[model samples]
Target: MPVIVLEASDFTSPLFLVRTLEILSSCITFSLVASLEDSELNNNPSNLHFDTFRIFCMFTWCFFFTLSLLMHILSVIQFHSLIPISWKNLTMTVAVLGALMCCAASVLFPWLIMDKTVSPRPVVAAVASCLTFLAYASESFVLCTQTHEQRGYMGSMPGLLKMFQMSGGCQMIPLVVEVIRELPSGVYMWQMWVTSVSYSVCVLMSLVTLVVIICDFAGRCLLPFDRFLAGFSLMGVLLYMVATVICFTKILQLRELGQQISHESTGLVIMETVVASITLLAYTVDLAFSIKLLCDRGHA
Candidate 1:
């Protein structure tokens, strides 16, 4: 019998490993900040200063949503040759386009609803935003599930893929919170139901993504191919799930707080801190991953 051992040094690319670890750390930090901030907002709806925060969050959400749509379109156009003309690809293409439209509509609905000055316009925007989030999530899932051979050039850069995922997750937060804020007080039943359903769905999706990533890392049969891209894709899904859960929890808490607490004021401070923390953590992870990639390249 012969003794055998496996070590981190046995890995081909130390740089890649380092980068991956950095990315993982950064993601965890982002989730922590986001979760904490959301919890704070739920606990205290007053004492948060600055009306600008709301506007900033709204603008940021819309900007990312628009950018995501544009990016997806560009990806499709750039990889047009790789796109199969078969029924399945065509169907996916159509679905992707449709999802983009839904996302656009959701992002813009708030503004449009504001102009109506009528019954339930706010609620409408909220519902639209939720739909848009679902569409985005679906689009990502489709992309992740595509066979590696079909992925084409899109599989090249893990960073770019992860960026899109983070962007989607980041955008989801404010829109959801905004909708909840707009709803009337004593609106417990509907909010509770919607929040529970949304959180559960998000959790399930995250778990699926985690499983995919784990399999990829284990070098299991690559169905969708491109492990690098898959890793990033899964990261996005996980991040989105975490953010959604945090947001939903905050909403649930706020609901319980009732009229005694000034939600807007408290929410602003809490959200600002949370968003700021999440943003910083995300950027840090981004930096760490970039460094790791660079190191790998240097070794190569």
Candidate 2:
């Protein structure tokens, strides 16, 4: 959830300056998961695990992005040894957070992708996902309020905007939906309810972040496409929230109707992938903005 938006000058390598590390890592994971789903979903009727496969892909995306991020942060240490202690500490914190998130993705994906009923405590999984999301949301809030002088170029609206977009996968919104989908028969009703609350809270924060961004733009225009993408990403988030909540509500309805699990697939689960793809594009826009900022504003 903690943001680590690297400026063009933040890295010694030209690769990271263009966001090549982030883009390539995300593409590799997305392609891998998509390939597995296409090959294994239909023919193996008894083992249709597309939902978990999607969740795995989402985790993989976050893992790789964070890994690239960590690599970039560490790479800075070798090039800028005389940088301020505060900057050094910031890099260390970012690297540590990245490593922890990667570890979480690695640990959770195996159980989530397992064929059998592996979800014993759905509340725990839901809490973990929501916590990560809230961290991202909180980070967005910080960036929205901070200025360029505070943390260099990353303190601008672009930081908030890009992070809000990235939250599509960063928050594991779809992952929570999938985890609820795969809840074992023995999963407690109260736990499910708790997870539902967590989901709603995250959606609420997403909207709130959008509101904050809009308000900031009303007073001071930051740059091109600043508020545009912020509002755009939130609209997508709102739609995803509505669709996901409806789908989740249907699952609860089926439960009350004496159905253990709903066999019918919700369109929203598929919609999540679309939303994520669009968010990825939003990130590309952010990368472009960062580059222009580096050239125009001059990186600190």
lDDT to native, each model:
0.42, 0.45
Summarize candidate 1's per-residue lDDT along 16-114 as a digit string, tens digits.
233233233323322332333333323233323212333443443444344444434434344433443332333333334334434543544443334
Q: Model 2 — TM-score against the truth? A: 0.34
Off by over 4 Å in 1: 1-121, 147-263
Q: Could you tell me how far off, in angstroms, the CA of residue 69 lies in candidate 1 after the best superposition? A: 9.2
Report the lDDT of model 2 for residue 258: 57
TM-score of each: 0.34, 0.34
On residues 277-296, what C-alpha lDDT tens digit does candidate 2 reach at each position? 45546555655665565566
User: Which candidate should be chosen as best, given TM-score against the real structure?
Assistant: 2
Q: Which stretches of candidate 2 lie over 4 Å from their true place?
A: 1-107, 113-161, 170-223, 260-300
| TM-score quality measure for candidate 1 | 0.34
